[model samples]
Target chain A: MDEPEFIAALRSLPLHPGARNLEDDCALITIGNETLVINHEMMAEGTHFRPDADMADVAWKLVASNISDLAAKGAEPVGVLLGHSLGRDDARFLQGLKEALLAFNVPLLGGDTVTATGASTFAMTAIGRATHHPVPARRGAKLGDAVYVTGTIGRAMLGFEGAAHHRAAFDRPEPRLAEGLALAPLVSAIMDVSDGLLLDCWRMAKLNNQTFAIDPDAVPVADNARRDECMRWGDDYELLFTAAPGAAIPVAASRIGKVVAAGFAPLVLGKNAFPTADNLGYSHG
Target chain B: MDEPEFIAALRSLPLHPGARNLEDDCALITIGNETLVINHEMMAEGTHFRPDADMADVAWKLVASNISDLAAKGAEPVGVLLGHSLGRDDARFLQGLKEALLAFNVPLLGGDTVTATGASTFAMTAIGRATHHPVPARRGAKLGDAVYVTGTIGRAMLGFEGAAHHRAAFDRPEPRLAEGLALAPLVSAIMDVSDGLLLDCWRMAKLNNQTFAIDPDAVPVADNARRDECMRWGDDYELLFTAAPGAAIPVAASRIGKVVAAGFAPLVLGKNAFPTADNLGYSHG
Candidate 1:
């Protein structure tokens, strides 16, 4: 089975109410007066990075990606547990892990390590404390809410192409933690843009039973000459949110679209309609 | 690097106080009036199981192993997040996961699924709530405390060798959750016996600055003739704990040894001395 089919099969098993029916990026567990947000993500050698890629970058990206999920939930990170496979450049992996932990100020909790014979796979679980009670979700968008995105899109794509100035965007993309925390209480809906902007818009709209009507010319891109490609490339780690038209955003973001009633498509970029998510962004099979 | 060396390097990174300096099986996160116990474990092809091994058993063991760590902490499991790599017999994996969740009465949280090239690796993060204050750790065994183990050892070893009656012991070993809960308030230290009885005993003794002296005749084993092999083979998933000799155990278990002042060796079996963990049990490296 493919990724979607496997996930669908998993849905049939017993699920926690906080799983958000397997629709959210993170899981919520409320104990006593605290609600913990947990997220787990994995990065494989060939699927996520090249076999010859720097192990340091792989380690950094692993932590960043999982923390990005907590950021989308508007949570304050507590710590992280790592599931590591020992292989070449382990010292580099340790260096990257240390840098990531220091950069994020999140301590290493505990995890397991094992010796494996083939391609390496690393996994991390990020635990965080919810900063907002009604933590923002992808399915909370309301009709007429304005869509917004932080930072610029396509920077990572440029970095992947060896663009000198954009290397950090690809090597060490920062999760928009502060932005998500600030927007959580105000936005009608919110999510992180790990996938392409157009694809993420499609996902959020589909989840909320609405349509995202985006102005093609309004999205902020790293290179205006390649704006279309920028909007379709992923790994930007920006926050995508929807809020009332007159609400104070309290962050630096560009207003690029508005939430509309359910239409024939979930996303509309100018006059083009994207009825499905295929070919819009990266997806593990 | 080897598993021990890699882990030793990890100790230099930022660590949560509840990580117990990476000497314990699980991490503790205290928030408000609640303390959360978290455990992460991984299973990989070739390293953890055979290439022709049943995926159903793999999935079951994955969940059972992680839950076993929580059991050692006397925590009530809240939920688990899975990190899965797509591979053959996924339906069988789902079947086993479903059965394990139902048997454990734990719900599935959110997790990520990825496609990888070779040697499938699966990871799980188990989150639980502490049922007792001062949650037990590997470093709490006190002098004069009696060392105990739940259930007979070597069952999994026999099952792995195709013993029909012991197949379930290897494939679907049950975590001693109830027994752990019962002993939490009374035991000075507790941990699951996953990496062989001798190795685990040595670990607990070293961590507590004490020594474990065991009488070979007093230990329980599934096969009397192969007692030595039984004590050295891993994957039992039973609880190994220490408590005052007079403390009410409230559970059925065998007294295998006693904790004494720091000795020349960390473990004493009959007249044999094991100064180091080497050759005592399973070590991933």
Candidate 2:
């Protein structure tokens, strides 16, 4: 079975009410008066990074990606548990992990370490406390809401292409935690843009049973000349959200689209309707 | 770096107080009036199991092992997040996962599924709510406390050696959740016997600055003829705990030893004094 098939099978199992039907990036678990947001992410060698890539960057990226999921829920990180596979340059991995933990202001909780043959795979479970009630979700995008995205979408794509000036954007993507917190209360829907802006928008619109009418020119792109590639290229950890047209966003973001009632497609870019998500962004098998 | 060195390096990083200095099997995060016990465990192909192992058993074992850690803390499992690597027999894996979830009465929270090359690696994060204040810890064993173990040891070991009657012990080891809950208020210290009874005893003694003087004959083993092997073979998933001598123990467990003051060694099995943990049980690299 593939990822989609396996996930579908997983949905058939006993699921917690907080799972959000496994549709959201993070799980919201309530205990006592606090609601915790938890996210688990895995990065496999050769799948997430090059075999020759720096282990430090791999560790940093793993932590950042998981944190980005928590950010989408406007959660204040509590701690993280790491599942480490011991391999080459483990010291570098530790260094990067320390740096990431310090940078994100999250402490290490507890984890397991093991030795495995072949390519290394690292996993992390990030836990955070929700800062807003009725946590933002991808399925809450209301019709007529303005779609917005924080920061440029193509910096990571440029960096991956060996752009020296944008290298950090790819190696050390910054999670929009602050922005997520600021917009959580105002936004009708929210999610992180990890799987390309257009694809993520399509996912959000589809989840909400709404249509996203996006103006291609309105999206902020790191490289204006390669706008299409920038829009389709993923790894840019930006916040994509929807809010009332004139709502004060309280964060620096560009309004790129408007949510409409279910129409011809989930996503509409100018005159082109993206009836399907094929070739829209990165997808794991 | 090896597991020990890697973990030592991790100690230099920011650690939450709930981490228990990374010496325990689980982290304790107190949110509002609730204290959550969280555990993360990973199993890699070849490292944790044979390549030909059934995917269903592998999935069940993964969930069981993580739940065992939570059980050691006298915590009731809330839910679990899985990090699944898509590979051979994924349908079987999902089947086993569903069975485990149903058997344990624990709901699936959320997780990430990724496509990976080489040997597959699976990870799980089990979260639970503490049932008692001052939750059990490995470092709380006091002098004169009696060391007890629930169920017989070496069952998994026998099962691994193709003992038909013990197959379930190895493939679907039951977490001592109910036993742990009953013993929590009475036990001075507790942990699951995952890394051999002797090695885990040494660990608990070392952590508590005490010594475990065990009576080999008093310990229950699945195969008395291979009692030594049983004590050294890990993956039992039985609860190992220390309680005040002659206390009203509510669980049916074998009292095998007594906690003593720091001495020549951390563990003493009859006439043998184990100064080091080498070869006592499974140690992940």
Candidate 3:
């Protein structure tokens, strides 16, 4: 579709009286004084999952991955849109899809389906309501705020390394919805750890113009093969959050470090941070 | 991401004030009297596009494909979210992505990027707003409504046959955004002809509980290819709409046939409806 054609068609629709940011991904549609915020995430075949992976797990993982993004912003789940590649259109696949959707309780609204030339892919867009307070953004962290995480990290990455239990952990890192919702009203800034702990922390710090200082020892470890490897290896979908030193938050959190206004780069134990030697998180170009 | 963990996080976000059904693929976010509808469609590599396809055209078609879906609904484009696979994050690739976004004039709302295990894929979620009147739906055709199409058909399929121009046409379709936007308020039912004339029309008929009869000769052809093959080949992506006779629609359309009380199967008026043929389109299991 031509961009103009799309815009023109959208403009032709009657403006919803309270819809704000109509042409943006996150819209603040107001009802009275409250705003509902929305965003979506998609996973593809051979890209997000292995073609030979378990179908039921694939469906479950797609939903989980997208919902994790919502959790980062403390947004409540409303529903989802699913686009399925025609490659995986068998009855067994459908059964798994149904199981995943039902398990999430996020009803399927509507979506398009097409045949794929090779490996199958699936996309899921998640919608949710924003809380009254500022929706937690990647830019909300402040100097002097302490950094914390909801659960142990590196398990998901470990799972990817052929450790069956760890692979399952990596495959299905639970969204910290409880922690996110609880912390939404308290945290300075928030984001989910999808890439690697060090990488995500670096990104969050850059977004907020702050530096993260991890004690290395304080960083929570999921299980043990190696703490540094876990931190650097990607796929740990946990919540990396920041709050005031004495915020008295009520989520299961382990203080990994603190946010500070010092050197530009993330630091570990008062030293410049690097994925090697300590953190083992993955990097994206 | 585990389904429960992901869903738990999503469920934690605050609810939108006007969302009637926020947890579905398509949701109604009411802003006062007006309600904005949102949906997302994701396409993948080896599924939607070849990994080594022209990056620029691939990106353009990705956006266009999702936008085409919105066009079919008579909904206007609002924004888009992209889930990109990090197979090869080269400068040229990023440039291609930027061009596609700029071409669509849709802002890059936040999206997730992850490295794929195999071929590259991209998932795009298009959020569109429905106009005051109900946007056309596949299930709205009546027993007597006439079926019509916008623009020439079958060029895309022909493109796949190594016809350079036809191939380009196949890869990049002129999404009938203008016609769809213009007809949304007027048409009873609307959809893009992504699959083919025979199959898509069949789908439309099935959705509306009516039988669609098409005079094969009356159907527009894009080239002098085999008549039967043209009817079954997929990837045309044109608007196949249905409306009452003489509805005074704004878009120029070619009349093909009419809707009738349910028929035993989708009917074709050529040599034989069945033709012992491949039907010219791709199929999903």
| Tens digit of per-residue lDDT, candidate 3, span A1-285 | 222233333343333332222332344444455556655555656556777777767767777777777777787777666666554534445555565566555565555455455556576777777764666666677889999987888788667777887766765556776677888888888888877887777767765666788877888886564877777766677888899999997988899899888573655444755422233355432
lDDT of 2 by residue, A1-285 (tens): 877778888899999999989999999899777899999999999989999988999999999999999899999999999999998689889888989999999999999999999999999999999999998888788889999999999999899989999999999998998998888899999999998999999999988888999999999999899999999999999999999998988999999999988886899999999889998898864
**TM-scores for candidates 1 onward, in order:** 0.99, 0.99, 0.79
Question: Which clashing pairs does model 2 show?
Answer: none
Write one digit per residue (lDDT tens) for candidate 3, span B106-168.
555444445555556567777666764654567688878888987777788778777887876
* CAPRI verdict (incorrect, acceptable, medium, high) for model 3: incorrect
RMSD of candidate 3 to true structure, Å? 7.3
* Tens-place lDDT digits, model 1, residues A17-51: 99988998999998776788999999999998889
Q: Which 10 consecutive residues of model 2 chain A have the lowest summed lDDT? A: A1-10
Clashing pairs in 1: none
- In model 3, the Cα lDDT at residue B111 comes to 48
Per-candidate RMSD, Å = 1.0, 0.9, 7.3
For model 1, the stretches where C-alpha displacement exceeds 4 angstroms are none
Off by over 4 Å in 3: A1-52, A85-100, A112-121, A154-168, A222-226, A270-280, B1-52, B86-104, B157-168, B224-229, B270-280
